[model samples]
Target: MDAIERDDDDIEFVETAYANVAEFVEQLLLPTYRRNPAKHRWDPRWWEYQEVAMRLEALWRSFEYLRLEGPTGMAVFFRDYLDPTMRELTSENGPFWRLDKLGDERGVPDAWPSESPPRNMF
Candidate 1:
């Protein structure tokens, strides 16, 4: 069908926009955004962290979708995805929390202690 063909074309366009996650981050993201080191944390080894990797992938997909929408596309992406994601990602307690400002890994903190709720409590 024509709709299916169009969908396939759109997918191809998005997939080819960036060669990989690293390319997106290194080429487009890092250069454009500036972070205050005093308030935020970052590690060059961001891909090593599972949460960071997943978030970056989601951001990349969102970017690919929004970029087709013309002028307001990036505004929406920044408001909806980039701002919140970068805030959480670079927060002190974010996935990079294990690393110090110099990117040295402080000892890992123990996982948060938790227990299952009573049956049917939900």
Candidate 2:
């Protein structure tokens, strides 16, 4: 969550930042989304997008609170938030909540792509 732990490649931040970024995701973000799926709905990807967007205002506040700007801010956003959510969304056992929520008594999951929940998500 702080600055990259190791910046071996000053020329390419991503290269040097990779390990630190993975560590950040695995350590902080991953736990929130992975171990505790209800902490956030990351399955089905879009739900995670929706959840993140719903908190966009807060995220922006965080962006400002952290005194981040431009690319650095974006990287922080990914490192602290998006990356872990993505991992959960794409996990082998992903979409857990989504699957759990679906398949009423009939036992047939609703693959309906009608609209985002809490409708009018825009």
Measured against the true structure, the TM-scores of the candidates, in listed sequence, are 0.74, 0.27
For candidate 1, the per-residue lDDT at 14 reads: 34
lDDT of 2 by residue, 1-122 (tens): 23322346643222223233334344544465444433433332332344433443343334333433565877786688566555554453444344443322112234557755795766
Query: Residues 64-122, candidate 1, lDDT per residue (tens digit)?
Result: 77777789998999999999999999899887787777666654346579999999999
Candidates' RMSD to native: 4.9, 11.8
- In model 2, residue pairs whose N, Cα or C atoms come closer than 3 Å (at least 3 residues apart or on different chains), thus clashing, are none
Strongest candidate by TM-score: 1
| Highest-lDDT candidate | 1
How does model 2 fare in lDDT? Answer: 0.43
- Give the residue spans of candidate 1 off by over 4 A: 1-15, 106-122
Give candidate 2 misplaced runs (Cα > 4 Å): 1-71, 96-122
- Colliding residue pairs in candidate 1: none
